[model samples]
Target: MREGEKEERTQPFSSPEFAPVKLGGGISPQLIAGRKAGKAEKVHLVIRRLLRQRAIQEGKAFLDLGTDSFYPFFQQYSATQQALQALGDYAYTARWYPSSFGLLQLREEAQRFLRTRFNVHIDMEKELMITAGASQAFDALSRTFQGECFLLPDLAISTIHTIAIANGARPLRIPLHPVSGLVNLQEAARLLEREGRPTIRFLYLNYPHNPTGVCATRAFFEEVVAFAKQFQVLVVHDMDSWYQAHISGISLPNILEIDGAKEVAITLLSFSKEFGLPGLRIALVAGNAEVINALRIHNSEYSVMLPEPCQYAALAALQAFREDEE
Candidate 1:
C-alpha cells in the first residue's frame, strides 16, 4: 500500500426497514475488496455473485423488512389460494403465450386498483405492461434508456445501483437531506449537465421510496415533469408503493396523473406486496407510450414471459385481497 494513498472504509450496519442508513456514502466491502484486488470491476461482480449465492445457500429469512411474502399459514389465510387451486386442471391447457403487455383482466384490475386506491388511471392496452417483477423491469429500463448518465439516491436498495452500473449508465449519487430525507431535484439535475453531455439519461425515482419511506406530493411531481421537459430528460418513476400502510393526511399519487407526466415519465407498479407473490414475479410498468413501445419490442425479444399459471395467480391476487396486510 502506498503511504499517501487513502483506503476506502466500508461500514455495514443492519437497520429496520423504512429506517434510513448511510451505507452507500461509506465504501462497501465489495468495492474496497475490488480496489485492493486490482481487478476492480471483475472483483465487484464476483463479490456480488458470492453474496447472492450465500443468500440462497443459507436460507436466511428476511423477517423484519421486505418479508411480505412470508406467512406461516400460506394457503390457510390466502383468499387467492382457492383461485389458484381451482386452476389445477385448467393449468394443463392454458394458453402458452401471454399477450406481450399483459392479460386484459389483470391489467383491468390493476388499473381499477390504482384508480380506486390512489386515483391514478392506467390505460390497459397502450399504457400499462406486465413484467416478471420490479427488479427485471428496472434492469430493462436501465439498459433501455438512451442517455449515458442517470441519478441514484445516496441511499437505496443496493440492486438499484447495480442495475445502473450493469447497464453502463453513470449514476450521479444525490444525497438525501438529513432533515428532509428528500433527494434535491435541483442538485441532481445540475449534476446531469455537469459533464456537458448532449443527452442526459433518465432520473430514476422510487417513492414511498425503498429503504427510505419518503414520498413525493403531486405538486412536486409537477415540478419534476417540468424539470424533465426543460432539460430534455426522461424521468423513470418507480412507484413500488406496494407495502404502504395508509398514513393519515398523506396520499399516493402516480406521476402519470400529473399533466405532462406521460410526455416525460414512466412509472413502475407491482402486485407483489398485496398478493404475497414476489416469487411469482407479476408487476407492471405503465405510462409513456413511446417508451412502452420501445420496451415492448426489447422485452418481447429478450425477456422471458412468466408461465401462464402465474398470470392466473396474479388475477386471483388482484381479485382476492381487499386489505393491504403488508
Candidate 2:
C-alpha cells in the first residue's frame, strides 16, 4: 500500500509447467478421450462399489485390490521398517536432484537383485537406468521410437495402448494361445506380415501378466527372441510383476535370459507393486545399452528426475529383500 513499494505479484495461472506435453507427434483428442474412457470403465466402477460394500460390512478399510497393491503386507515386513528408518536418516539429501539415470547404489543393488533372484546379470553403468516408474519408462520408450506400428497383447493394460496411441503409432492387438495363455506368435506374425512387417518397430509384452496372470516359459522366450531377431523388431518386456512369480514359487523366465535377447529386447523392472512402494515412484530398465542410453538422453530433457530420497529408499528396500532371501 505504500508508495514506491511494489505489490506482491501473484503467480500466473498459465505457466510452462502447466502447458500440455507434446509427446512425439503430439497427443490427439481421441487419445485423451480413450484414456479417460479406459479409466472409467463399467468394470472398474462395479469393483469400486463391491470394495466399498465389503468395507462397510467388515467395518474395516479396504485398499483397491484391483491394483494388486501389497502395501498392507509390505508395511509389516521387518525390512520395510528398517528401510524406512534408514530413508528418514538420509531424507535431507533430497534437496538435490539425483542423476537422471538414478543413484549408483540403487542401480548396484538392482544389479545384485537381478543376479541373485533371476540369475540375470547386467552392467549397472551401461545396461541399466532407473525410471520414475514403469509407465514413465514405457512412455519415454514409446516416444523415443515412435514406430509406424506397435504389436501389443490384445488384453494388455490400457496404458500400453494409450501410450502407443499418444505416440502417433498404430496399435495392432495380437491374440494369446488358448492353452498356454502366452502370446500366440503365429497370430502375431500373421498380423505383422499383413501390416507390412517393416512398419513394426516395437512389440510390447508383460508377464505374470496383469489382469490375465500368464507367465512366459523359457521356450516361449526363446521363440520370442527368434521372432524378434527374424522380424527385426524391438521387444519391450515389462517384467514389473516378477515378484508375483517368486511368491508363487514359479521361476518365470526373464527375456534377457534368452541368448541374443539383448540384441533385440529390453526388460523393465518395477518395485512399486512388488515392494508396495508405488508412492516412491522408482523402477529400472535393463538390457540393451544403446536403448538404455537413448532413454537416458530423452528423459534428461522431457522427464522429471527421481529424487535422491526415493533412490535411497529403493536401495534400502532392495537390501532388505536380499537379506530376507538369505
Candidate 3:
C-alpha cells in the first residue's frame, strides 16, 4: 500500500463458517417451515379439515352459523333509489374531489341530523367528517392515534382484529361480560388503573353493539367519560346501529350527550347499516377538533374520501329515514 492511501475496509466475521451440507432432495428446511404457521393461520387449516370430514359424513347439506356476518337482503327504500337516480348525470361530472373530511353538503346534512337527532352541536368544518365506512374510518383513526397499546374488545369485527396489527401496534384485549354480553367495564376500569391509563391510549367501545347486539346506557357512557378523562385515554364509541335503536322503539343515547365527552371521546355513525348501502360505503365521524383534523390529514394521504354522489345518496337515506318516521 502506498503512503497516505486508505485501506479498503472488509466486514469482519463473528464466527467460523460451516461446510455446506445437502438436505433431502435439495429442499431447504429453513426456507420452508411447513410446521411454523401461527395458531391463527393453523385454525383456518383445521376448519378446512373439519369441513371436509363433515362433508364426507353429512353430504354437504349442513349449515354453519359460526360467523357473525349475516346476509342482508332487505328491500331498498325508494328515497335512496331516487336519490341515486337523481345523481345519474352528476356522478360522472361531480368528479371534483372533496375535502378529506368529506363532502360539504353531506356534512351539513349530518350536522342537522345530529342537532335534531342527538342534540349535539359540532362545527361541521372542523369537528365532523364523511368517511368511507366503519372499517375505513377506524383504520384511519387506529393509524392516527397509535401509541404504546390500543385496547380492543375481544369480541369485535374482524376489521378491529387487523387494524392494530397492520400498524405494527401492540393491542391489548378487553373482554365483555360472558353472561350479559355487555362490555366488562369494571374489568376495563381495573386494567386502566393497573396499566397507568395514559399508557393505554385508547378504549374502543361499540354499542347498539355488534355481534352481541347488546347496547349500553347513557349512564354507562357517563361513567366511561369520567374514567377516560381521569386516565387520559381517548374513547372511541361506535354508533353504527343508532338508527336500529329508534326503529326497534329503543332509545339509544349518544355519548356526546354526556358532559365533557367532547374532550375524550369521538363517535362513529355509519350510514351503511341504516341505509342498506354498504357497497357505497359512507359514514360520519365527529369529535375533538384537533383529533378530527388529524384524522382528516391522515385520510387525505392514506385513504379514499367519500365520493360526491354517494354523499348525496346518504342525504337521501336521511330523507327516507324521516319519511319512514312520518
lDDT of each model, Cα atoms only?
Answer: 0.66, 0.77, 0.69
Q: Tell me, by TM-score, which candidate is best.
A: 2
Report the C-alpha displacement of residue 316, candidate 3, in angstroms.
1.7
TM-score per model over all chains: 0.73, 0.85, 0.74
Model 2: ten consecutive residues of lowest lDDT: 1-10
Measured by lDDT, the strongest candidate is 2
lDDT of 1: 0.66
lDDT of 3: 0.69
Q: Which regions of candidate 2 deviate over 4 angstroms? A: 1-27, 30-46, 53-58, 61-71, 244-248
Which is superior by TM-score, 1 or 3?
3
Cα deviation at 326, candidate 3, in Å, is 4.9
Output the better candidate (1/2) by lDDT: 2
Residue 214, candidate 1: alpha-carbon lDDT: 84
Pairs of residues clashing in candidate 1: 132-281
Q: Which candidate model has the greater lDDT, 1 or 3?
A: 3
Question: Taking the tens digit of each residue's C-alpha lDDT, what string does model 1 give over 48-142?
Answer: 44454455456543232443345433446454574466356358536666665677777887777767666666676777788888888777777
